[model samples]
Structure formats: structure tokens, C-alpha cells
Target: MKNITCLLASILLAIVVQAQELKLKPRKADALGGTAFAHSISDSTLSLVAREEIIFREIKNGNVPSFLRKFQKIVSKATIDNKDYELVFFVLPDYLAIGHNDDYFYMPMTPILAQKVANLLHCSLPTRKITDLIDQNATLKLTPQPIPPSKAMTTVPVFITHNDLVKQQMQPYLSQHANGALTVGNKKDIVISNKIYGETTPRVVIYGWHQLDGKPIQPLYNKHTNTWADYSHGVRLVQNTMWLNGKKTTLAKILADPLLSQLLSDEGIIEKSYYPVFDNY
Candidate 1:
């Protein structure tokens, strides 16, 4: 009995140590953005549509916050069919934000705009498995902040309010990762799902917003139209190019691979990786 107890303790200790050793470094995205675009959410006359245009314009001109320029390296290791594989990818340290670091607002956009921004930045949206991998390896995690449902949920004021709430939740760690480190939780990700394939109706698929204990508040869902976006929704850009088994490859190739797609997608393969672009946004 004593020998069995000792063996169980040893296994527990190993698991604890492995969890404690999880850490990641920022991959410098110096060329991404440094120009600061200062915008105020207090503008009541500006409609959400107008605000979205301004957000896109600034980002297109490379006027995003300095912190977002830092991509964090996320590594995932898996063993399938008795073969070991490791995939390394980089992601923006946090959700896509607008304006200066001190005055930024986490911008929520329709899937159309999200796709446009992703294309402009040479980035891609995360999959369900990718979201889980990122959350599991995130340097810091926070509780999800959800506002009461209302028409204003898609407005800028509510968006700023939720952003501020998230800031408060992450306040204690601000000093260590001033510009917003690789963080998980706080917003539901606009992800690529297999459901989007061959659907006659355009829809938005979202997942994530994990709690501190790593349980996700939102499950894989696509009930909303593609153009619908709310304060709780956030867009995270993943670097298109990733390292697959030590060889640099594109997410396009990896996601379309027969077996390798499992690393980044839970629901089989993601053939239609992006939402159809709408110019009206």
C-alpha cells in the first residue's frame, strides 16, 4: 500500500511540475504596427458602422497599438497513431484592438470586416482546437465578462464598457505585460468552423471565452448571421505561417492536411477557411 501511494504521489508531482513550467515568449512583429491612432468612443454621433470604417482605415494605415505588434509563440504537441508531432504558431498577443495602448478599445466587427482585416494583416482566424490550444498555453487568463443582452450590445459604448471590465480583471498583471500579453478569456473568438462549409446562408461561427479554471463559457455556435457582431465578440489574428514539425509552413497547408488539421481544428478539416467578404462593412 505504501509503494502504491508513493507511485501516485510521483505521478501527481510530475503533472503539477509540467503545468507550472508552461511559458511562452513574444515573437517580435516589429513591422506590423507602431503608428498610434487615437479615437474616442465617447462620440455619440458616430454610429457603429461609421466607427468600424474608421477602425479599418487606421489599421490599414498601420495605426494599431504597439503591444499588438508583438506576437506570442504558441506551441502544441500531440501524439496520434503512435507518431509524435509538434506544431508552433504565433498569434497577436491579444484580441484585435484599436487606438493607443492606454486608450484602446477591443474592436468587435462583423465576420466580413474580420476577414478583411485578417487578409490585410496576412493573418487568419483561429479554429476551435486552436482556441483551446492557445487558452491552454496562455501566459495569463481572465474570467469572461458578459453584459446583459440588448440592442446596444453591438454598439461602441457597450464595447468599451466590456473592454474596461476586462482591463480591470487583468489589472494585477498590467505591470508585467504592460501592452497586453498573450491573454486568454474575456472575449468569444470568431473562429472557422466546418459548419460554414457549403451553407447557403452566411453565418458567423464563434467559440472560446474560457473561465479561470479553463472551462469555456461559449461553445461552438453559429446561430448568428455573418454580419452580426456584439460586444462580447472579439477578433484574434493568427499568423498565417506556422512551424509544422520544425518545418515552416502555412496554416492553409496545415489546416487542409488530412491528419495535421487535428492540431488546429477539432471538427474534421476546415476547407472553407474564411467568411465571404462583404464590401459594405
Candidate 2:
């Protein structure tokens, strides 16, 4: 009876742990953002960054294995510290799991996996207390703490802003999340595109983000200024605006194009966002 009870408790704990899902937000290739821990930099971040460099080197070395060869387009170069750099680091495993409602990929935080990642990248481990960032994030302010001397390994989330593939994954949730509705904060006008509504015409749906008391975020539009501002720039939306091909196109226009629309509406992409990502069974 004692053994059985212990087993049952263990199973229950596993179930609870498995129930936690990691969600990533949508980010475009050109989207700009940073993810530095308040305390000291974590080992996972260094490992991830170093691994990225290795991946770049592999492609450059021209001895990339067959499996990696197939990913030539993605494994092209390493420009992390460069300007034309388009990818933004979103999540670093030490405190949180930053992902999107769409099909965002996650890197597991197992001891062996984490250690191997560090070894392969030749980076030092992030000190302890890195996981304590949750305390600071609760206040939604920057107050990073350094990791102390400890042997415990931690998993945290890092958001990497890069590529349309990631943005598509983040779309359904960012634009129309069911549980947590998107609330626009302060701003003059909110310009929505057909991309969010699955339409075409370069049409701009302008809306206001500011509200008094309990009033809802209202929509605003004007024909005079081609600029459809919303949520006072960064304060409103959590991520950077999608600048498709460096051209600031409207939402309606993107929807109008059959090619763009089809890419956005791919069944494989949509299903991943709708269903549980890690549920392979």
C-alpha cells in the first residue's frame, strides 16, 4: 500500500507538470527586441547564442551533414552581432518559456540536454537565481538578478524575433486569443490590416488604444494621413510590427494577394497553433 501510494503521487506530479504549456508570441524577421536577464546572463542564453554561431560555422565550413544540408537556406550565415541582423532573441531557458499561440518551437530543459548544449557551444553556465526572474516579471519591470553558485539547472523562456514562419505561428493568438483578449493600451490610432482578418485590399482599419475608466479600446480611421498609428508604438502591442519585405504595406493588401493569403492560411500551420504543440501522440 505504501509503495502504491508513492507511485500514485509521482504519477500525479508528472501529470501536473505535463499540463504546463509553453506559448510563444508572433515575431517577424525584421522585428527588433532584446531578451537579457535582469540578474547575470544565464548559461542557457550563452549556449544558445554559441550554438547559433556553430550552426553558422557548419554551413560555412561546407562539411555540414546531410540532414543539416537540407536546411541550407536557414543555415546560411552568422550575423548575431551585426546590424543587418534580423533575428531577435526571444526566450532563453532559465526562467520562462516564451513562445506563441502559433507553432512555436521549444528547446527542452533536461539536465543532459542542457549540459550537452553548453558543452557543444563551449559557453559557461548561467549562475543560479536566474529562475528567480519570475518574481520580477510578475511586476512587469526590469529587475534581473544574477545566478548564485549552485548545481541546480533551470529552464527559462527566450523570445527570438525572426522570420515570417514564426510570425504566422504567433498570428492567431496575438490577433484573436480566446482566453487572454488583446487589450490595446494608450495611443492615438490603431490601424489594422486585412492580414489579421484574412482579407485583401491594402485596407487600413484604424483604432484607438486609450480608454477612460472601463471603456473599451475603440477603432479610429482617417483618410488624410496614410499613417495609421495605434497603441502609442511599443506600449500597445507586445511585439514589433510586421514590415513585409521592408515595405510598410497595409493589412488589406496582403490579404488581397492570393499567394500571400495561401501561405498565411496553410492548414499545417493553422492546426499546430490550434492544437497542443508537444502532444505528439
Candidate 3:
């Protein structure tokens, strides 16, 4: 009887642990989502600094792409410390974008804003190990299209251009995913790592713009300042919730654990796995 009861409980726990979904907080009524807001800014003559501020504010107040609300679940299982472990977690189906309804554009921001958005949505950036896992398991893999780097890469015009390019790339997939799907390889991801823990000046760590061959173009690099956001950068949020060995856990907690940290981190224990969110980076 005891063994039978344990088996039933295990089955019930497995059912509950599968593919959890996370929804973003509700936006205010009549408030603009990511759609009208991004288009308006592209046509305006606002300075780059001004545009970034408003973009951050709009996102903070919940003006994000509607598709972002439906977080996609990803599961990873592995053996660490001579024990098998399974991790199930939720992530944004698409890279963070700004829009409402069916209209939206993927937006890139500095690590400062990325961390702030993660905090707002109760999500965190991915580690290198998880970044690779997402790419490997994503349903759609878009070829990365990197615009030539220039000073204007940080400008709104480039952002709009990149958005159009990405939309064009997605046209063939629209029949399958009208709004979005679990996608990867289109842009370099803003990631969390122990690399930033001791940097003299705060730096943004980016990785993973994989090719059709499944090889990444960028490496785990942190030379860029947290304030330097380019057109190629993307923010994909991973929900803080993590299921470890069929029990409720979090990235911060598991990452701090020496043994379980092997599941998601390539750099060993990442006790501090996120950037410090701040007004000035």
C-alpha cells in the first residue's frame, strides 16, 4: 500500500510539472501596447536618448507585444553529480517585442532595460547552457541576419529596419504561427553569467546567434557596456520558476546549488545570475 501510494503521488506530480504556462501582468485599459507606440516613435524626431527612455517606460508600464503573454514551456533533463534531474521552465515564445494585437516589432535594449523588464515580468535572462538548450529545442530556427555595424545601430531607424527584416524572414512561417512561435537564432541573446560579477564597469554579456548549421556566431562576451544596445541584440525572458527533479524551484536557487547548477550553467555556480537593474547603467 505504501509503495502504491508513492507511485500515484509521483504520477500526479509529473502531470502537474509538465509544460507550465506564464502570463504577463495585465495592461491598463485603453493603454497602448507595443504596436502604435513603436511606429509613432520611428516617425518622430526624438533624440536617441529620449526614445530609449520612452521605450523603457512603455515596456515597464506593460506596453509589450501581446504574443509575449503566452510563455512557452521548455524541459531539460540531465545527469549531474551522479543523479538524474529534470528541469521544466517557461520562456517567452518570441524575443521581446513591442506591439499590440497582431502588430509588433522585436525590440533590442541595453542590459539595463532587459534586466528591468525581466524583474517586471518575474523572469530572468538565460545562462549559456540554457541558451543552447532553447536553440536546440526551438520549433522554429530563423537564420540570423546581422546588419552592418555602425554608430546608427543604436538608433530607432535601424531598429525599424531590423524588425522589417525579421518579419520578412517570418513570412514563410506565418501559416503555422500567425502571431509567433518558439523561435531561435534570429538575434544575439542578452544573457546572465558570473562573468559580470566582478567587472570594474558593468558590462552586458551576450551570446547565441546560431546559424543554420547550429553553430553560434557570437561567443560569451562581456566587453560591451550595459548601456550599449545594438540592432542585433534581443531580450528573451525565462520565467524564474524552475522544476528541479519534479519539485518547485527557481533559477537563483538552483544556480546557487553547486550540484544542480550543472543543469543550467556552463560556468559552474552562478550565485548572482542577473544584472543589477538600475536607471543609470
lDDT of 3 by residue, 42-135 (tens): 7547765666777777777776655667767677888866778888887887788766645677888888888877887788999988888888
lDDT of each residue in 206-254, candidate 1, tens digit only: 8989998888889998888887888888899887877666566888887
Q: What is the lDDT of residue 258 in candidate 3?
A: 87
lDDT of each: 0.75, 0.26, 0.79
Model 3: lowest-lDDT 10 consecutive positions: 17-26
Question: What is the TM-score of each predicted model, taking all chains together?
Answer: 0.82, 0.18, 0.88
Q: Rank the candidates by TM-score, best first.
A: 3, 1, 2
Candidate 2, superposed: residue stretches over 4 Å from native: 1-185, 188-191, 195-203, 220-235, 238-281
TM-score of 1: 0.82
Q: Is candidate 1 or candidate 2 better by TM-score?
A: 1
Residues 131-231, model 2: lDDT tens digits? 11112222111211122322331222222222222334435445333233222221222222322233332223333323333232433333322222111
Candidate 1: worst-modelled 10 consecutive residues by lDDT: 19-28
Stretches > 4 Å off in candidate 1: 1-49
